[model samples]
Target: MHELVVTPLGERRLVLRQGSSKALQLPKARFEELRTSGSSAVPQWLADAVQARWGMDVTGRPVDDVLLLREAGPYAFSRATWELNLGCDYDCVMCYLGEKRFEGLDMDGKRKLLAVMRDAGVIWLQMTGGEPLIDPDFPKAYRIAYELGMQLEILSNGSRLHKSHILNLLRTYPPTKLTLSVYGATAETYDAVTRNRGAFHRFSRGLRMAIDAGLTLDLSLIIVRGNAHEADDMRAWASSLGLPFREYANISPTIHGGAETLPSQSPEYLTNRAPFTGCPAGVTFFHADPFGRASICKVGRDPNIDLIAEGVEGLVRLGGIAESLMLRTGGCSGCKLSGTCRVCRPMAKVFQEAKAPLENYCQHGSR
Candidate 1:
């Protein structure tokens, strides 16, 4: 079947690809028209624009366009985040995987896992970690995923990306994007957060090299109390680079239930609560840990099933199990605070040391 892949580039721009050969960036409105009205309704100007840019022969491909547009239906699992390993070189203060032993799947095991994901219809795969680059076999695994036609992404600190071998691998089989976490604006503050001397310098050097290599890059600031003062500077630095930047404030407990990295949230910080809807974990998204244990989301990891042993079908089966568990248990059930409560079943499971209603997460008093 012909596949027309639509990927959002920015505010109103989108990149539309036909198979792996032809791709062109067009306005979102035109893409929507093509999506809803089929290829026959495609404006003559739009067709000419695509053909002029990519030199694709669209003379008698009307049927193919219609089929491709219609192919954008729901799949069992469309995207996945695989934590290649929990190992990282720098010790960041706010890291989630605290002192957790790194146990990633071997090369052969990773190949099998990728095959399972492909069979399960996952089109987008994000390779993340404490730092995915730390994995020795990451390049081979990444190449395998690229060859399998998965739109891939990597989340890293950019410390090792400047290395010749790593850069060569990235240039050879480029990922869809690379998301680098910027700890702080300056070397002092950045190294303070990382707890490693000269880490900021390494990160900056690697980031520059990656940019020079023409890798698509995005940056995020992991805002914690330590670097809260430099938030503006960090944002400004990211703006200087002209890359997309985001800030994350909410700090969850460590993935391994270790000591809390950041301090407890103030009552004022907890007061302004947004409405709680269910997260798209087991349903539409899944996170696989180093050893192939699959969870609904990274923060809401629970009832984790071994994906290596049970395979993709195991994940599918666990979705219902996870959903049922979330709906019935924890402080979420029939609680008035559910509207404003940030605590979900998985969070409750992680921080279950306290009583119900999760006073730390509730704007209202705990029940």
Candidate 2:
């Protein structure tokens, strides 16, 4: 009986709570509208297609909405994320990016990244680091991304957001999104994950400052095996703040140097996962590190290929990166749970390192 969310994927969906589970309820009427609307139309030639099937009119009306029919296809990749660093000030056990001490991206390094993204024709670029705000060039880098005609998203630990200069950027260039990580419900839970005593207050206060500065905000909570019970409380926290939230299962350990801290969730957790129709790794997204390495995922940084050397167009043609992501592997191909499985480069890396069959990380195929 709740309101329906008309997503860009051409689906008018509603979320219903059945017992302890939250189910996304979609109607048959909206599905038909999605098919007939010009706004929902997707380029038939593109391989990355979670949003491809939903057609729309010139003005962007979903076919399902236009025809008042049932919707089809999965709604995924509502957005894309790019990592700016593998380093973090805190050693969180669940973070797939920062289990070790890694250096932040410098100013010059970030400009090259922006240039590479523009050349790749990316419309959205996210700046993520051990904590992006920790890097002094964050504001300048965000502006460079915007100047390149790309909307920006920032994932920060919220430590440096309290600065007036940083707040000025939030008021001026204002990113399309700003995700602040809330590790725990209280300082004890937060400190446990961050391993820093006062991080909880800094993050909380910075978050409030950002919200007050008029930045579009969202939240992320990485759920380790030991912290699974925090799901309900996490959701409540997100709701209270009126932010779109996500609680991800920590699978890949944050790999930097020789440190790989894996989450407690095993392969069985994704056994019955939902089918992800396609991977948009190289098509809809391309990540560029501070050092100018262009990769499909952030965790693929160690041996990353340089975009400056290969060039964006050549990289896409030779990499065949996007195509590699669509193939299904064990547990993903025919699993009933395929509908909800979240596969990224990190998962792919683990599968490959273990030499597991059908492990498609980056959603891209093996090299």
Best by TM-score: 1
Per-residue CA lDDT of candidate 1, range 1-367, in tens? 3424444322433434422334566676766766665546446666576578666555445633522431221335667899888888888766768785678788888988888776665667899997889899888888777665567889999989878999988876667789999888999989998888988999999998888888888898887776778888999999998888877766656777754653632222223445556776787678888888888878766678887798866865657856775663554466655655655667666665333234555555534
Clashing residue pairs in all predictions, respectively, total 0, 47
lDDT of 1: 0.71
Shift of residue 118 alpha carbon in model 1, Å: 0.6
Per-residue error (Å), model 2, residue 273: 3.6
Q: Roughly what TM-score does model 1 have, to 2 decimal places? A: 0.77
> Best lDDT goes to which candidate?
1
Q: Which whole-number lDDT from 0 to 100 does residue 268 have in model 2?
A: 35
Give RMSD to native, each candidate: 6.5, 12.1
Candidate 1 has its poorest 10 consecutive residues by lDDT at 66-75
Q: Where does candidate 2 stray beyond 4 Å? A: 1-82, 98-101, 256-260, 263-272, 299-304, 324-349, 352-367
Q: Would you estimate the TM-scores of all the predictions?
A: 0.77, 0.64
